[model samples]
Every structure is written in C-alpha cells, then in structure tokens.
Target chain A: MRLDQIRPGHVFLLVLILGATLWYLLDTLDTSRRLTNTILVVPLAILVFAAGAFELIREILRARADPTTLEQRDVDEDQDSDQTPVDMLRGVVLLGFTGLLVFFYPRLGFDLAVFLFIFASLVMLEPRGYLAKAAFAAIFTLIVLGGARIILPYPMPTLIL
Target chain B: MLDTTAFSGALALLGSDINIWLVIIPGLMIGLVAGSIAGVSNTMAMAICLPLTLYMDFLPAIMFLTAIFTGGGFGGAVTSILMGIPGTTSSVATTFDGYPMARKGLHNEALGVALMASVVGVLIGYVILLLVVAPLGAWVIRLGPAEMLLIALWGMSMIAALGGNSLARGLIAGAFGLLLGTVGMNTAGHIRGTADIPFLLDGIPLIPAMMGMFAASQLFTLIGSGYLIKDKTARRADYGKVLSGFFQVLRYPVFQLRGTLIGVFVGAIPGVGSSVGNLIAYAQAKRTDRDSESYGKGNPKGVMAAESANSSSEGGSMVTMLALGLPGGGGTAMLLAAFAMHNVTGGPSFIDQNMDIVYTIILGNFAQAVLLLFVGLGFLAIAGNIVKVPITWLIPSVMVLALIGAFAVTGDQAGPITLFFFAGLGWLMKRYDYPVAACVVGLLLGRMVESELIRTWQISGGGELEFFLNRPVALVFAALLVLSLLQPAITNYLRARRARQQD
Candidate 1:
C-alpha cells in the first residue's frame, strides 16, 4: 500500500487504542498479579490490541488492492463532503476556543469565561452580526449564570454576577 | 394477583388525600426541567428535592418523588430528540433516531412520538407492576452474577450492530471504551490507569464523558452547517404534527409492547436501569424490524422502541424498590432514601403489610402518566423551538452549557477536562467511521461486566464452565446471546434461499 492512501487520523487512532490498551493491561498486571484483577482486563485488552492490529493491516491491504475504497470510506453524506480548508480551519478554531474556555473557566470565573467564549465563537462563526452576537452572548451568559447560582448547591467562582 | 383488600384501601387512601394529587404536576415539572438539562440528572433533582418531602405525609412524599421519576423519564427524551445530546443516560438511544429525525426536519413528530410512547410505556409498566410486582420482585432477586454478566454481554453485543459498515472499527471502539471504563480502581483495590489523578479513583465521570462524545463531537462536526435542519419551512413546531406523531406510535403496538417489556425486566435489575433497557430495546427493534436499515437514519419506530423501554423502566425499577427495597438505579436509590426518611422499609414484608400503600403508589403513578400527556405537551411546545435557532449560535451555547454541566456533575475541573478530552476522541472516532455509541455502551457496561465476571469466578471457585452449566438462567441468556449474534446471518440466508426459490 502506498503511504498516501493511509489516512493519518485512522492510523493515529488505531495506534492510540493499541498503545492505551497495552499500557492499561500492563498497569493492571503490575498492580496485582492476581487472577481476579487481571481476569477481565487481560483478555479484553489483548483482544482490543489484536483487533486494532488487524484493522490497521486490513486497511493497508485494502488500500493496496483498492485506493477508491479508502476514499469512499471518508465521504459521508451527512458530514459535508465539500469541507474546504477554511471550514477545516473554523473547526480547529472552535475546538481550540473550547479548550481555552475550559482552561480559563475556573480562573476567569464561569460567567466571564462563558460570555467571552460565546461572543468570540459567534463573531468567528457569523461575520456580520457582531453587535447582535455580543448582546445575545451577554444576555445568555447572565441568564444561565443566574440559573446556575440558584440551582447549583455549591458556589462557583465568578468575576461578575 | 390483585389484593382485594389492598385495592379498596388504596382507593380510599388516594381519595382521602388531595395533597397527594396536588404534588404530581409540580414534581413532573421539576423532573422535566431537570431531565432536559444536559448535566442535571433525575437523581440530582430528586436529591435536591428530598428534603422538601420530609415535611409532607408519606404517600404525598412518595407520590411527589415518583412524579419526578415519571416526568424525568420523558423529559430526557426532549433533549435527545431535539439535540443530539441525551438529557440523561436513559435517553441515549433516543438520540440515535430522534436526532436524525430532527436533522431531517421531523423534530415535532419525533418529540410527539417520544411523549406518547413514554406515556404509554409508563401506563403499561404500572399496569404490570400492579399485577405482578410481588412475583416479579421475587424473580429479579434470583438473578445471580452469571445472569448479570450475560446481560452486560448482551448490551455489549449492540456494538456490532452500531459498527456502521465496519465490524472491526466498531469492536475496536467498543474495546477501547471498555478499557477506558476500567481506568479507575478495580474491585480488588488495585488502580490501573488513573495516572495518579485522585478523581480517577471512582472512574471516569460518565455524564461528562457522554456529553462530550455525543453532544460536543456532533457540534464540532456541524461547524459548517447553517442550521440543524436545512429546510426553514420544516423547522416550525406544529401541534398538528406532534399529535400526528403521538398517534403514529399506535401503529407500532407490537414494537411498543416489546420495548416496554424489555424496559421493565431490564430496569428491574439493580444498577442496570433505563439506560441498558433503551439500548436493549433499540437493538431488538433494529434486529427484528423489516426496515432495520433505516433505524439510525430516522425511523420513528426506533424512537418509539427506545422511549417505550426507557419510560417503562421506571415501572420496572419501582417493582424492585417497592418489593425488595433495592434501588434499581440512582433515581430509585433516592426513592429508597425517601422511604428511610418516612421510616418505611420496603421488602416482602412491606409489600405484605402495606399492600395498600404499594397499590396507592402504583395507582398514583398511573395518574402521573396520564397527567404527563398534557403537561409534557406544553413542555414540548417550548422545547420544540430549539430547531429554529441558527446552528452557529446553538453550537457554542450548547458547548458552554455542556461544559458547565460537566462542571456541575463532578463539582470540579475534572468534569470539563474529561469532556474536552472525550470530545476530541469522539470527533476522531466519528471522522474515522467508528460508532461512538458502541464505545459509550462499552464504557457504561465495562465495570459492571468486570465485577460480575469476578463474582462469577469466585462463586464457581474458578470452575466457570461448570458453574455456568449449573445456572439455567445463565444458560438461557447464553443461548439468547448466541441467537442475537447470529440473527442477521440467519435472516440473510433465509432471504437468499427464498430469492433463489422464486427464481
């Protein structure tokens, strides 16, 4: 199989599964060599690892025999087949924004962090509706914050209420 | 099986208390709102409200709690149908077909169908509980570890059906989930994959993980879409369509009955409740239906099957809690706490002595189920407007809510962090054609399967084969599992043979 036919995402996921399975299996065995501890973990992990290996090998072989199959596999009708580089970038940006939101949530306070995330995400997703987006973001944040304060038993950190 | 004395006493007790009837609507409302929220669970809602019940009489308190239980069952479906996110674990399978229907501009119908099925499921469940709560409770207690393990295996079998064109990818995803599920400490007091994180001691927080996988992952994939439904005209919520959808469930009585029965039996098992019931019901529906290929794509029957099973599970679970004092799941656990608060103990003795109260509870639930029809209709009218929102706005808003919910669930950063990690993992799995649902199921059943296997082993003294042979119930389940596994192949062979004969 040509290297070009191998989808890096597919390979990466398979390897991650295999690596995690092996690591977990080894960890369980290391913790205790007892039959009870390892009974479910050992067999299941080995099976997963083998399955991951088989899938990887099968994909490679399929790629060699039929390149079109690999291409066809990636094309889902529900998932936009025409996903441009710009759309890809948007997805990445959204993902990064979410990660940042989570990272800053406790630090910035739930209310402020959520407001900023929503505002920024709206601005990024909808180009012409900045004022509307900001208003919606602020209002939405306040309402949810108010509800959270009332509903949640424990207090959350907040910059402003 | 009807206790004549209890029946008359129950009727008198219910008639004497106007307060009992008064709490039902409010309890259902609280439950609906709680169940629809991404992070808030029915147990959490009930737990928060448990103290309020302390001031009330016993019947009213139990009725209020049960009202919440009933409302929450259907409430979870609102989010599951409207958004890809399941409001609670019970509604996971609802999202499989319900969300697809929403995407296809059938949100109203989907919601309507879910509501009707849930109502009918509850009614049927209560009817069964009324008739067989005594014997059924006795039977459910007889289920040993072997049976539980087989049930877990049966749930795991769903991974094959969900694999979506690639069995290997599906199994790999499921196994990966199983590994993730077993990440925390084992039953033997050994920690395997915690990486020294203190919170991992209990295992990955399930609700946060679920929100990340199903909701966040789907949101990420919808980055380019303008709206949830492309057809603007179809996006409007119509009462007519909803009523039509409600009536539509009547056409699939057999499927509804099957799902309801599965829900009751599965939900009766402690620790295994509506979540597994819905999956089992959905799997059976998919396996048996002629249009099985349309299941995940947006078959209303799929929604009916899932809703009926999950809703009916409340009844099934009630049987255990009422008869054996064993909580079937978290909601019932809260109910048990309420029972304690009232100085009421549930068991065979409780059933024998307080048969009137048991009948009262069951009869009260019947009223709650019927009242839910009208109350839920109003709730749906408001909830159904979700389709009109622009995808761009909805995406960020939902993601934020989900993160907040995750935070609420874990009471710390762990929830949001787990959600973020799983979201990334889920997106990758989705992109690579792996079924995230299978993985979710695996994660859910993983710990249970392991614990049960260990128990089975201990009981058998390491002679599992011999022990399994002795378990008639286990043997029956084993046979059923084999049949379920081979059903597709058998059906295909029969079809092929018929085609050849016709030729």
Candidate 2:
C-alpha cells in the first residue's frame, strides 16, 4: 500500500523517526541527562502514536461501512460540501501576501513594512467601509509603534535614514 | 518558602518605583485592550509587549509581563460575554455561561462574576504558592524526561476534551502540529527538514506560531463570519452587587476549592495553561452540578468555575517555574527566558538564595488579582467600547501587531513566515471541524515528547515495551491513559443505549 493508504503505519513511521532524531540530539548536550527526560520519552511517543493509529483505523473502519452507519451519514451530510475555489484562491493570496511582506520587511523598514502588510491583509479580508479601514490601520499602527517606543526597548530600525 | 521580606519589597517596589509602575500600568492597559478584542489573545498581547520589556530592569520587566498576563485574562471575558465570540482560548469556556447571561440582559452580573472569580482564583493559587513552593519544587525537579514526557502526553489528551465529537480530526491536527514541530533541526545534531535554510536552525518560536494559529486564523474566520452586532444596550450592573457575586461564589465552597485545585494542578504542568484550566474546570463543574442540565446556559456557577479556575492556573504555573526552573506554561517560559537574559536562574536554589525575589513574584500575582477586580470593574464600559472599532480596521491593526510580534520573536522574516504556515494549517483544521487547541498543545509538547521517547528507548536497550510495564508508577499512568481514551466512547455508547431503551 502507498504510505497514505496505511495512515496509521505512516504515523508510526513518523513517530519512530522523530523519536530517534531527538535521542541523537539530546546525547550531544553537555548538561545532566536527567533520568526522566532520557528514559520516559519512548513510551510516551509510542502511546501517542498508538492512540493516533487506533483512531485512524477506527475512522477507516467506520468509513468502510458508510451505508450502514446512518449516524455517520447524517453527520457527513451536515458538513459543507461546497468548498469554493474562491476560498482556495484566497488562501493562496494570503500565503503569497505574507511572503511578500516578509521579503520586503528588511528593505522597507519595520514601520512601513508592517503598515503595508496590515493594510494589505485587511483589504484582502474585505472589511466594510474605506474610512473604517483607514482609521483602524492608522490607529493600530500608532498604538503599536508608540507602545513599543514608550514601553518596550525593541528598536524598530528605520529605512528612512 | 514564604519570603515575607521579598513580598514586602516587591510591594514597596510597586508603590515607590515610579518608573516600573509607569511601565506596568500602560502594559496592563494595552494587554487588556488587545485581549478584549475578538481574535486577539493573551499570548499575542504578551508577544507584542515583549519588546518593550527589553530595556527595563529585571523586576520592572517581570512586573510588566505578569501585569499583562493578569489583565489579559480578565479582558478575554469581555468579548466572550458581549459578542458571543471568545477573545482567547481561555474565554472559550466562559462563553458557555457568560454569553448566555449577557443575552438575558444580566451583563453586569456576568462581568461581576467573571472578575470576582478571577480574583478569588488567583488568591487561592497564591496561597498554594506560599505554603508549598519548596516541597513541590523538589518533587517536580526529580521528574525526569520520562515523566515529563508522560505529563506532556497528558496535556495533549486535553485534545479529546477540546476536540468536541471528532476525536479523529483532533488527533490528526495534533499529528500535523507534531510534524511542524520537527521542521527545524532535531536533537540528533543534524538538521532534518530545514531544506537547507539557515534561519530554521533554532526552530520556530512558540509565541509567533501561536499568534498566527490563534489570531490570523480568527481574522480569516471573522471575514467569513461577517459583522458582529453592536452591544450598546449593555447596562452596568449595580456596582454594589460585586460583593454579592463574590459571596455567591463563596457559598459554593466545593466548586471554588475544586476548581481552584484543578487550576493549580493543571497549571503546574509544562505546556498546559489557563485555557486547559478553564476547559477542565468547566467540564468538572458540569459533571458536579446538581442541575447539570442547566450548564452551557446562563449558569453563573459555570462562569465562576471557569473564570476562577483559569486565573488560579497563573499562580500555580508561576510557582512551579520559580521553584523548578522548568517552565510550566508559555507565560512562564517567557519569564524563564527573561531571568536567563538577566543572568538569573530560578529553582529551589533560587528560592533559598533569593527568597525575596520569589516571594515578591508571588505577591505580585495576589496584588494583580486585587487590582484587576477594581480596575476591570471600573473600566468595563470603556473597555467594551473596543468592540465598536470596525472589523475592517481592527483586522489590519491586529495583523500588523501579530506580524511585528512574529518578526520580533525570530528577529527575522521566518517568524512571520511561520505565522502564515500555521495560520493556513489552523484555518484548514477549523474548516475540517477539528480542534485548534489540540494542534497548539501538540506543537507545544512535540519536542519534549519526541526527545524523551528517544531517550527512554536508548535506556531500555533499544527494545521491549516491557520496561514501561516494570515501573509501577509508569504502569499506573499508562493504565490511566488507556482508560481516559476509552471513557468518552464508552460513556457515549451507554448514553445512546439509554436513549434507545427509554424510547
């Protein structure tokens, strides 16, 4: 079977790999290897994976008898079947916009970059009223920048200079 | 352990230190405002406030941090009650009772209950801190990675409670979180999934990823959910009735003590925080309520149980961190880092050596509770006005703040990048009707769990599960895990059978 086909097996494989990786890393640390930290991780990982596997197998089993499971059918029927391309496109756009903001943040300066990112994200969400959008953006920017200056010491490097 | 001198000194610092108070007050106010807004969280508020603490003295910095935490906890209930949308995960339980009460036009009463319960809960937790910090500290210190791993898994089991009816989907989301947690370099001295990116070396910061998962995803949902109704009709409850509400909460001694105890214990566990405290307390209250059917409606008892319990968790969580030097929750982890940066370490030794500081921190939580009662009540109206801020503007503002916080935490764009990654995943979990809390818990505990499991395997000579069965304590815990997983399904099955029989 393909890896995804045997869902629980895939989970076990992942857990095993993750467990091995952590063990290797912890060995390299110079600190006291507290017995609890060293010895208890294996069972815990095994238990989590086992629980997850059981849940997955049960779900698959239930799905197998889809016609017989009237309750399951009823519940599934209530679930939204109409996932729009617009939502998918919107997700892509959100991901892209976030990437662009991070990319330009160093060059554009903290204030400008943050402002643009906020403004773009808001506009994309399509909040009502232009005035509401502008006012919120300005107010939020002021509070954050002003709060940082007065209360926190995190220097916002400016590109203006 | 009861460092009276330190407690007094901390109080003196609060009263006399003009500069620290200045930082504390504003930070508290900002955190309150941020936490009250739908889609904003205490974690997000603290992350935003973190950069401000960088320049201050350690005491003042710590004071400001805890103040935000205290204020944010109360602030979350405001939106939860008024708009039927939880301001933070902690308030998710609050909405069950608080919103219903609000709908009945007893908004003031609900607010009063929440504020009073929060204060009482904090006091109970502080008392525990004063009495048993050292003993508890020593005990927790003895807990190895093996035990910590079990505890973290216990915390993750909260996903079952949070996941609602779909345990499978919830575990899947949790599994996804575990996968994301492994994206950085592993404990094995080798990078696993960094894809050769240098910034991924340090791993993702908890705060930024959480801000994205909780805040950004909420913004997405808000867009889809559409506009919230304005609650201008809100009437102030008789301010005098605040005492009456407190009395009402006290009358139920069992509820108060049980919820507070739950809060303290849950709070002591690393990775579990107020959100779980509220959830567990609410569930417990429901089970214990004589009129259990009245729960999830306008039950003031539910409000008291959840709000008080959540507030208490802060006190319990802080004590464990100070005594053990092991961070029990996100807030304490931040506190731990702050101490390390200042060349200070907290643990049993710290309590013994610097009794004054430890006492002062404990006193601060008590003082914070008292302060929250008065300030939260007095400014409810002004704070509630935050909801009037249009969603269009509010969304952008929050995005900017979350973006800044994310970037600051990582000192690079990767922080914000992780936000998008998690936010997308968060949105999917929501869309699929899965539990977001499970994902958060899983992500938080993934590393600790993975490392401990690996270590345990090595110790067991890389073999047989029989070793877990050998240790009596581990075996008992293992048995409990099985029972916990099965209990829900069995209960539901029995309930269904009963209904059929009745028919």
Candidate 3:
C-alpha cells in the first residue's frame, strides 16, 4: 500500500491491467449474468489481478520484516540508470516515433509508412554518415517490397496496412 | 500396414513431382528466416505461406508446409542460442542454456547442436510414425476432453521454466497470462474482456502480442550494447565450431533419445504441441542429469533436449492430424487448413483409404530432414552476421520488421497496436522478474482450458463431478497430474529419508 515501496514499471502495469479488468467487469453490468460472464471472465480476471496484487504485498511485507538490513527495490535488473542523456533520449524518441508511425500507418500505406519509420528510426539512432543510412534504409525498403510482392501469398501485403 | 500397393504408390508420388522440390527449399527458407526473427513464429510463417500450397497437389502441399515446420524447428533454436531471445514458444526452453552458452562464447556450438538435434529428432519422430501411426492414431483418439484438459494443465505446470528460478513467480506469470488469454470470448458467444473495444472482441491478437513481449522487450534490454556476442573471437562465425557442435550432439545420446520420445508422445496429443513437448523434455533433462548443477549455465545437453523434442514434434503432430483429424498444435493446425484447401480429409478413414498418400507425405518429410542439415548451415552462415550488428541499429531495424510482421498478421492497425501494448507489458514483466515464457504458455492454452472445462462440466450430467471417476484415460491423467504436482515434495522427502538413514 505504501507508494514508496513500488517501482515505476510495476505501477504502470498494475494501473493498466487493473483499470482494464475493472472497466470490462463494470461494462458487463449492462448485460445479463451468463455463465461465461460470471464463472469464467470475472473470477479469472480477479484472480489474475489478485495474483499480481498479492506479489506486491508480499514484497512490501517482506521488505518491512527485514528492517535490520534495508535494501532499496528500485533498480530494474534490465535497466541501466547510468547513461548519457542521449541514450535515454534514444529510447524516448524511438518509442514516440513508433507511436506516430502506427498512427499514420493507416493512411500512408505499408511501404511509405515503413520506409519512413525505418529512415526516421535510423536517423534518430544517430548513425554516422547520413547518406549511408539513407541508402541502407532504401535497400531495406526495396527488399521488403520485393518479398511482400513475390513471396507472400497476400493480395496486398503492403497496401492493406 | 504397408502393403506393396501403398509402397509403390508412395514411390510414384515422389517420382512424379518437380513442383514438390521447388516449394520445399523456399518453404524451408521462409520458415527459417521468419522463425529466427525474434517475435515471428513458425506458425505465423506457416500461416502466411499456407496460401502458396493452394496451387499445388494434395501430397506436395502437405510436404511443403511440413518442410517449413521442420526447418522452423531449427530456425527458432538459432535465434534462441545467439540472441538470448526465444523465436517461438518451443524455443523458450532453449534459452535456459542456449543463451547462456552464447554469452559464454559457445553460440556456434549451441547452434550446431540445436540443428543436429532437430534433424535427428524429426527423423526419429517419422520413424516412430512409420512404425506405430495406425495403432498410435487409434489410441490417441481415445483421449477425450478430460484428457485434453490434463494435457493443458501439464503444460501450465512448466513453471520450473528457465531452470527452476522461482516457482512462485512462474505460477503467477502463468496465471496472469491465462487471464489475458480468456479475455476475448467464451464458447457461448459472449465477449468477456473487450471493454467495449470492437477489435478486442476477437481477443488479443496473439502473434503481435507475442512479438512485442518477446522480441521488442528483449531488444530493450540490449539497447546500450554494441553487439549480441560480447567476445571478439565468437563474432567471427567459425564453421569449424559449428561442425564441432553438430557432432557434439552425438555425445549426448541419452538426452537426444529421451527428448525424442518425449517430443513424439507429447506432441501427438491434440491441442498440446511442441510448446509443451520442449518444456517437458527440458524439465525432465534437468531433473535427471547427473551434472544437474551445470544445467542452466551453458549445458549443451539442455539445448539438445529442447531442440530435439520441438523439431521431432513435427512428426508427432503429423500423426495426430493425419490419423485423427485433430491438430496437434499451431503448425499442425495450419497443415490441417491446407488439407481442407486441397479437398483432402484427415482422420482414421482418410488414412485407411489413402495409405499410399499418407506414406508419401511421411517419406517426403524424412528427406526434408536430411536436406535441412545442409540448408540450415547455409542459412546460419548468413544469419550469424546479426550478432555483429550494432545494438542501436539492431534494435530499431528488428523492431520495424517485427511491427511489419504484426501488421501482416491482422491486416490492420490492431496488430501493431497489440504488438506495442504487449511489448510494454513484456518489458514491465521482465523488469519485475516474472517469467514471460510462462505467460506465453498460459496465453496459448487459456482458451482451450476454458472450452474443455465447459465440455467436461456439460458432459458430467449437469454439474455432477463424478463423470471423471469412470474414465480410464482421465484417471491415468489425473494420477499423472497428481504425481507431477507432488514431484518436488516427493523428491525432497526421499532425499531427507536417505540422509536420515546415512546418519
């Protein structure tokens, strides 16, 4: 329950998953109480939420019990905090650019969207030699277009998206 | 069961097909490249390539898809070894040791061992199929919904995944996954967790979600690194090491044979496929090894066990499909779809009537296994260069390909959206030390679990729980489930008893 005990990643997931589960459960109030609704979805969702919630409680409680040697549970094993500002910006930029690409993808078509996404992503990654990056992106685009046209059986592998 | 007529018929089928050869190499390559990509699976590759089979005859069509399935078996292993990312559910267990080996600069040997084990595993599975498919088919059919439920439950118990890190954490992850899986719908046509989103009515897009969780999240971990392989010498891509690793599989005969047996039997069960087979095979290997301490820390035997079982499951799944009209897993499900497209039926009667055609498909896959050895080497030699790519470029480029692949699956923004959502979820889960493999397994089996539970309940005479009491196969599975559930406790008790006796 203590806010200090939780990490940002956990907070994000707990809020997202719990919010969605509750939102769906509440939406069912408009419908009839069917077996699938009650016996299946409600209990399963609650159990999943409870499982995650329980783990958090256990961590906090265990941390409190061992007060003699305090260890901060703030570090994510996969994340490295000691980084240049540029390294941090690369992640943020890559994520934001991908979101934009996904949003624009419906209108631009697959080829244009993917080409732009790749080019922008490469540039944002701050690769050396701008011309080489552009050429690399162009070659990758051509290969993708060729593969989509010739190999895949879909009628519009690139065009549909 | 092989009459002279059927033997000659199989020979004629093989001799008459030039189209078969054309599709074989392409299909294998497609499966390999796609499966080796972090998030894309053999099933996804097979699904995309399934339409190509429509233009061919029935036997060749079956052969082509199975070739892809077979090649993907190893293709997935390659990525798992070199990249610390499992290419598919089956390759999840491969990472327990394969990735460790890669980190230790043993990636070449790991890849070679995986390839060798897969080739041998596929060969063994078909050999078993050739011998006992009729009898095995008949027996496999006797397994009802209850048995199927037990099989699914058995898969759910693969919580000792990633080398028994933390059983509690694994179970929580699996439970969380199963919940996500049951989100979209119930058999009664009610959408459960759509939250008024129409796109979610079909449930979460599995492939995209999987791509995000496995590929994107793992890429995030390597964001600051320069290359996949840290050692300078390992980056050279030596064929000599590859050959040595290929032969190293011979040194682990016990692991190979045990994994092969486990693969075929578990893989033959409908609804459970190599996803369970690879995990169970790896778990068993870990449990029984004399040098168990070395298991999760770069053991070649672990790679062999996982790769062998997953690849050979191709034969195992084929047995279930051809003889029972049931899909053994996702890959077999695609094969069954091809069967329908070619206007061919699969089941007991299909085999009885077309014994020659059945044998022909089996024989064709055997040759495909031998060809996989050569083709895999050529493929790996090129794909191995991925480790040399700078991490910054690698992450974004691969992520883009993964996004495109996701789009290709659902043909809409739903795919890419799901991919990103799951990638974030996967990142959080990974950050918090939950087993993503357990979650993926749960997602794969959650719907099946619900359906079979409903069927069991309905057939139990309006909620009478005693319906399972009289079924022999169900009883056997029930017993096995109990034993599996108690295995750790039982082992501990025995170990304690021996220690007390020594005192």
lDDT of 1: 0.88
TM-score of structure candidate 1:
0.95
lDDT of 2 at A46: 49
What ranking emerges by lDDT with the best candidate at the front? 1, 3, 2
- Which run of 10 residues does model 3 chain B get worst, by summed lDDT? B159-168
DockQ scores of all models, one per candidate = 0.66, 0.18, 0.39
DockQ of 1: 0.66
- Candidate 1 docks at the CAPRI level of medium
lDDT minimum window of 10 residues, candidate 3 chain A? A74-83
Clashing pairs in 1: none
Question: Which lDDT values do the candidates have, in the order given?
Answer: 0.88, 0.65, 0.77
- Where model 3 places Cα greater than 4 Å from the true spot, the runs are A1-6, A24-35, A40-43, A55-68, A72-89, A153-161, B1-27, B37-61, B84-89, B160-172, B286-299, B326-344, B462-465, B492-503
TM-score of the first chain alone, every candidate: 0.84, 0.54, 0.69
lDDT of 2 at A101: 72
lDDT measured at residue A48 in model 1 versus the true structure, 0 to 100 = 89
Q: Write the per-residue lDDT of candidate 2 for residues B1-503, one digit (tens) a residue.
A: 45567667767766766665555566567657766754455666676667667788888788788888877877888766765556555676787788767656566677778888887888888889878888866665555555555655665565554454555555556665665455465564444445568886666666567667666445555554333323445444456555666677878878878788878866776665676678667766765555766775688888888888888888878878888888886678777877876789988788888777776667666767777777787667564444455555555565666666566556566777777776665665555455665566566656656666666666666646786666665666567556656665666788899999999
